[model samples]
Target: MNLSGVFYLGWRYLVRNRIKTLLLVAAFSLVWLLPSGLALVVSKIESQLRVRAAGTPLLLGQAGSPLELVFNGLYFTKPGIATFSFGETEAIDESGLATVIPLYARFSVGGGGGGKYRIIGTTLDYFDFRGLELREGRGLIDLGECVVGSKFADANGIGPGDAIISSPETLFDLAGVYPLKMHVVGVLSPSGSPDDQAIFVDLKTTWIIEGLGHGHEDAEKLGNDARLPVSAEDRAAAGETGGEIRLNASVVQFNEVTDENADDFHFHGELSDYPVMAAIVVPTDAKGQAILKGRYGRPGGLQLVAPSEEMDELFATVFSVQDLVLGLLGATGVGTLAIGALVFLLSNRLRRAEFRHLLHLGAAPGAVRALILFEACFVVLSSLVLSVVGLLAIDRFAPVLVRSFFG
Candidate 1:
């Protein structure tokens, strides 16, 4: 018989038992989706992580845990860790082995429409180093002005000229730490990294939040002006004003920094000793990285670590878990295939009378066998197509699905 004739007969048999064909296809498709879908998700996470790690040549921090520091630096997940100082970055920069960028990520805020996002404090080099481009408006140039990530901006309906308020780290603090309002200056283009979920600001901006820096109208200038009420704590923060203390309480401490008052923002003591959670080090060469690593690889808390190596270590554990799951899945797949085979065999046995009648009616035995083979091939091929299509769909949609559910 011609190929088309054989296909027609096989298709007729499948359609005659359409319910059985549908069940078998559904079963096998699910079997294929589980393992393949999980693998695709893991691979997507690993690829994104490696890309972030590869961009930073090395990290220097007062690292009690290397993994914690690396993840906090790259993924912006862990923030309540020991902090070094800007002095470290200055030291590395002076060493001439690499260019160091300080990162201070200790707080988060509620953006427009109540979407939560992290507030990252770093220099303009952070944008250039990360290769982030502005999708709208301009980059952060002044303290208290922030450039939001595309994901955050889109999710919260934030655009240039909108504002976000920092969420207080604690509800109760005797210190005069108040929630500051930050003006959104720009929206960053999506980069498919953790940065896409963060708000970038000048390093001084976070210091202002931390009370280490402040900019306000001179309390001294507000002499004898019966203005807004000023508390004692606000008065103390206002500094020495040699006159009748009738300063505007709002001007006593800067809750917001603007271009007009940017110069007024000053840090007490040496900036070199200012707290920085970590420093991203980009060395000129492999030798420079090795040398810096050797210099800071001390027995004390301070240490230098390679982010890519730390990421590898992290995924080693992930791969172990993946392997165990895949092993169990493989066993389950085998059991399922064996059951499917048994069902096929029993089904064939039940059709023996039909085959015998075909043989009796001048149909050759070989022709009956060929028909059986064709039916079996048709079932297997249909199942295979269903499995492949399901896998492709899962692979394509897995990242977006995961982001929607988890992120």
Candidate 2:
């Protein structure tokens, strides 16, 4: 019996029933691919999350879910997490045990395609802590000036000197949170982190966007048309000994902060009372970290957590679910392989008459057996190749998918 001839005969048979062959290959490929692909994606997400979490020593925020605080501080996610007064950051800073970098990431800027990127209000210390470098221009300096991340700048075609407007909290926002146009002063180098997908601005600029600060024409300069009627009782309540002028809705409030009106922008209340979503706490040493943690150990309105520990707890639960899913997939894969084997057995039975015809033509029984074995090998090898290819594709694209999903 010619081995080459047997392989040729098997190949021709598979080609003649190409639909069945393709279906079997596809089913087998999926059986091998699903579990492996899932594990690859989960591992990628875990590494990414753990690396970022490990870099930050401690995260301080209002008492809430530790996972939510970690996500907000590290990834600029969970924007709706409870916020604490900026004075909390001040207290942490005054402790001298650690350096506190405040973060206010509640607002977002919308892209033309309807996607939104976080607006991270932070200080120059944040750049140093993250080791971020500017790819183009400079860092945040003045009011309404911003520095965009490389990914954001590339996706939106933004660069130094370009401007972006904050998206209003809602279409019908009655809270007076108007969109503020901000000038892009620089673009950050690609860091392959969440920072690469954010827009960084001065903390005060975000407050302006929040309606806590504003700039407008001087009330004293406004004409009678822009002045609200003030009754004698109102004037007495204001402690006005003489004529007093009050500006009304007709007075124009500056939406964009320019050098001309920058000085006019002011907050209505104390800066210490301003809201901060979270703070990244960096200790001088291990001892300092322990001391700081111990100080916040007691129950209070604020909580300090070690991000790495929080991540460990999160992945503990995640791994349990992952194991359960893998078990189900393993069972499914076994069932699929059994069905594939059954198909081959029934196909061989269906080709019994053809095998007999081959024997009459002087082909040995061993040659017929070899032909059947060759076909089975081809299907299994083809499916294995497809599964390997699918895993590689998952490895390549899983990070992107995970980042987008988490963000």
Output the number of the lDDT-best candidate: 2
Error of 2 at 79 (Å): 1.2
Tens digits of per-residue lDDT for model 1 on 1-407? 35565567667888999988787767766677678878888997777678778888888889599999997788777778899888879988998899888998888876321336778999988899989999999987777899999999988899999998887777775677777789998999998777788988888788888888776666566545536655677766877453435644445676777667767777889988889998899997889888987888878968999889998999999999999999899899878878877878898899899878876877666676777788777667777788788778877887676554333
Query: Against the hidden true structure, what lDDT does model 1 obtain?
Result: 0.80
Off by over 4 Å in 1: 1-13, 111-116, 170-176, 215-252, 259-266, 285-287, 353-364, 398-407
Clashes of 2: 0
**lDDT by residue for model 2 over 1-407, one digit each (tens)?**
89989988999999999999999999999999999999999899999899989999999999988889999999987888999999988987897888999999989899421237989999899999999999999888799999999989999999998999998767887776688999999999998899888999999999998989999987777778998888888789889975667777777678999989998888998999999999999998899989888888888778999999999999999999999999999999999999999999999999999999999999999999999999999999999999999999999999888777653
TM-score of each: 0.81, 0.96
Query: Over the full model, what C-alpha lDDT does candidate 2 score relative to the true structure?
Result: 0.90
Best by the TM-score measure: 2
Q: What does candidate 1 score on TM? A: 0.81
